[model samples]
Target: MLKHPKNAVMVLARCFSDLDRRLLLLILIPPLSLIVFFSLSSLSPVRSFILGRTILHPQQAVMLNSTDSQQSDVVFAPSSWKDELDRSRIAVCLVGGARRFELTGPSIVEKILLEYPNSDLFLNSPMDSNAFKFSLLNSAPRLAAVRIFRPKPMPESELQLRVLTAHNSPNGIQGLLQYFNLVEGCLTLIQQYQKQNNFTYDWIVRTRVDGYWNAPLDPKFFVPGKYLVPPGTNYGGLNDRLGIGDLNTSTVALSRLSLLPQLDAAGFHQLNSEASFKAQLTTRKVTPVLKRLPFCIVTDRKYDFPPVRFGVPVAAISSPGPLSGVKCRPCKPVCQGPCVGDVMEGLNKGWGWTDWANGTLELCNAHGDFDEGWEKMFDKVAGKKLSSERKRVWKLTVEKCIANFNKMRNRTGIWDTPPVDEICKTGITSGPK
Candidate 1:
């Protein structure tokens, strides 16, 4: 059993080589697995978790403006403005608070990219410094939305009264108060961006986070010298439903709170979206162009139209609907001997609603809960590239958004980046654009 000293050295060398190989494999697998995981997540198709395909067009090309029937799906317009909004022109703006955006965000994106393929999409939401806020919306005409300012939650007494009576809603003035703040923000956007950039919009289309659309907005709706809004579902007056106004008109209309005193001094009372719609026109001398749109309010409130004291549900014909300013889907054409005749009749005549009552309703069933099977349904209607972008962001869970958020918060310059100023030309920097 004599063994040479050199034999022991060889055995030791073999063991060392095996140990090195093991170490290499250990280091390599985790990152490789992570890479695969991230890649797979990116590849998974994006489905609107809340607003499904109900409001989107299955084929994206269908959304391109009729005139520019061959535009690209992704439009990065080099940050410019088109002042005179023509019938052929498209303008898109996102109006939301950047909270719970994941629920109905896709519907807004799909609708804009679809309806106004030739349009430039603008984002004007306020978000927290958290990375999750604007991730769903950074895909299109992205401007750093305003920082959302939510007042401290009021006491239960005030909350109950505010919630119960339309007159007592926060910031009073009923009918989409936050909408006015958002409008004011957008108007600020228009004023600052336009002044610095010397650019204007033909039409400013304002929409919300929870509005799930079932169909595309047809171009025939745009008539000159008129603001277009969805009719019916106007609690007392205009729907605030979705608004599209030219620069001259929108400048004042979107100035919600600021304009209220002007409206009030002009004898505006019992104003809701509907009454305000009339007052904005009758008082301010701006007439609205009523159009039946394909969208439904994705709200958290319950309405008791008739026979049900205060908390009866007004259900949609379809579950996940765009409900595009049309007659609501009746569970049965003639249900229960017209118990909710007022709700049904107001819908039928088309008060201030911009829904699609002519045919089927684009239903959205996110009632304090998201719709089921929405993923598949959304996939059916979403644009390929947009879906891909959403997938990319979600999969990566891009945490850098916090950086973007903070960076925007620290920003003081408002006009530098808008279409008006050339960084090279201006030399003096104003942080916000």
Candidate 2:
């Protein structure tokens, strides 16, 4: 064994070289593996976990990286967009029944109207028991017009009959016509305001009276050339719940009634409201930009649980959601975690589907009216200020309501509603309840 000392030295050198190679491999593998793993996570249909949050989709990854994501749920418009909103004249068109205005109004004022303080608010709603609750908006920064009309039957023309269908509408074709009238009425109000003020609005934000906003409206939605709408709840068409656009695009989008003839000419038929909305826009060459927004339509309507493929899925109001104009109600969540995943997986993505990933959605039973003491649930979720507003409305009296309406009238550019007494008396009595 001691015969060849030089050979032994060469063998020892080879072993040392092999040891160095092994050490280098050890040093490189972990970081390289991490690089590969992260790269793979960026691909589609793959979920990436970062900071304990799941990046469920490619766009979500972009969203997380963008300045749009914030620690607080309240999302602000980019500084540039904020500047644009400040300089630009914005007309906020609010339509729909004031079913739960007491619960929803403060959020709208705080999140949207106040977010863009320069924007003018125009409301076109049918007068109902809840109409008096709209006095909550007296606190709005800018008031343009308010129209609380007694809804009447809209004449369905031949073209409307040809183009629209009554399939899923609870009120049939008449319902659609009334909705179209409400939307167009707001547009008319805006136009009249412009003529009176001698200045045209640069933007219009069309939303519903019953939309409860969980966060501030993102300013990125104000796309100049495109009409921005929420994603999902599209029944064979685009989501028509909320819309934001520049003057030209908004004109086309808001002319829901007047655009029927054009849609008919383009060979679109048997359309529901959402479908008709999509048809009108596409026929007019206005591109719809689908963006997830931080508001939901507050509804008292009940729907099936664990929704079937085409059935509507009712979301819980407390869900950490952008909701994107989906129907939601205040209730105890009946489903969460994997239960939600399983339920949402069964629904049609083109129908009532909404983003439920990363615990963003929770389901409400919605098989009946709001759960007992849902008010407490709402207060907890909405926090103190909004909860106080809700309490104020609950205890509102005719005199106070009238005073609130008068205050709103004083600030408003045009007030086309009935006498303040009539409006207040309809919803509230002589004294606090």
Candidate 3:
């Protein structure tokens, strides 16, 4: 039974030879395959593709650990933010009269409307000569609602009289009430739309029709959990000209008429629009975030020419700004550089004064009506397309105005205004026969 050692070893090797080969293949193949894979992944394009897929696809999110996810969330690129906004539902509530819609409307359409084409527009304005110009909104991507009601004088309640001031308000306390009604009425319209559709908006942008935007509304301004408004022109309160917030915060901000009782109860007396706005937000515990927005309230109201210190310095429409809702119009800039510093130094910081640092402020001689040849100035600044709109409005006929209004009315989800004929003809015909 015992064989020679060499012969015995040879027999054993023959028996195990097939098992050795299989073990060798299994152990070597995996490491070899991994080496090849890493070698290919070392190429720039391949590496980038792998990383990009990992970042872009949430299904692959498991590849990143908790630390990596935290880091990635902290560093958001602009494109990512834009993508988020593109997916979000936004309501752009435009209130106030369409006094200079020719100048401001095109800008709103191009900047806000076109920039976020998915957003819905809610327009609540009073019927006036300028009302016809709102038909420009037909170009909007989504027209949610339109209410261009004729102003029957609102009976000023004793509470409104107690809570508001007439100082600097042209129509006095009644004017403030009317303006408040217009703003709050827009909110009511928005609420109704939400209820009917059975969906809620993610963001609400409340801005004036008279505000002329020079640049698109930035996505960065839409801060979560806090309401955003322009700084300066506080005038014993916050700037009420432009606001952006979520539905909860905007509900607090836009409840102008409903909040009067609360304001009165809180002993807030003789508050201007801005002051009242600040009170409402503060009392309701809404956090306000101020950022310089790239627009100005286009106004025909004249200020002192070559304004002295403490005087309102109307900015030229062409001034480089995030003007923060300062009063502006088309005119040649008369004051700039050191002149701006000197003029602003004399102005009260809490009043209508805006941030004029870094030569951002430019003055206009607003002593009289928009100076002759101002159209040329405005054209140069607003560019050809907007200028053409201005010209169209100037030459708008009774028939065309009616046609445009009718088109907009048909498109609007909610239309509450005078008959298209009455709105068109009242402004078109000159005489009080």
- Give the winner by lDDT: 2 or 3: 2
Q: How far is candidate 1 from the true structure (C-alpha RMSD, Å)?
A: 22.7
TM-score of 3: 0.82
Which 10 residues in a row give candidate 1 its minimum summed lDDT?
424-433
Stretches of model 2 off by over 4 angstroms after superposition: 1-77, 430-433
Top lDDT model: 2
Scored by lDDT, model 2 comes in at: 0.85
Candidates in order have lDDT scores of: 0.48, 0.85, 0.84
lDDT tens digits by residue: candidate 3, 348-404: 766856778897889898998997898899999999999998888778788998888
Best-to-worst order by TM-score is 3, 2, 1
Better of 1 and 3 by lDDT: 3
What tens-digit string does per-residue lDDT give for candidate 1 at 1-433? 3299898888899999999999999999999999876655344234232323222232222223222223434321211212122234344555665443443566566656644555655556543332143445444443423434432333333322332235524454333555556666666765665566566666677776556565655544444466776655565566665777767666656766566566656756555545655566666777665555766554444333431322223345343434544323223222222333443444434333333334333232223333455444444554464345445444432345444434544432231222111211121132111
TM-score of each: 0.56, 0.81, 0.82
lDDT of 3: 0.84
lDDT string for model 2 (1-433, tens) is 7479999999899999999999999999999999978876664334323333353332232243232223423223367556757888999999999989988999999999999999999999998878999999989999999999998877888888999999999999999999888999999999999999999998999999999999998766776677888877888798888999889999999999988988888999999999999998988888887778999988888887767887788888999988898889889999999999999888876665667889988989988888999999999999999999999998887889899999999989989998989989987863332
Better candidate number, 2 or 3, judged by TM-score: 3
At residue 192, give the lDDT of candidate 3: 98
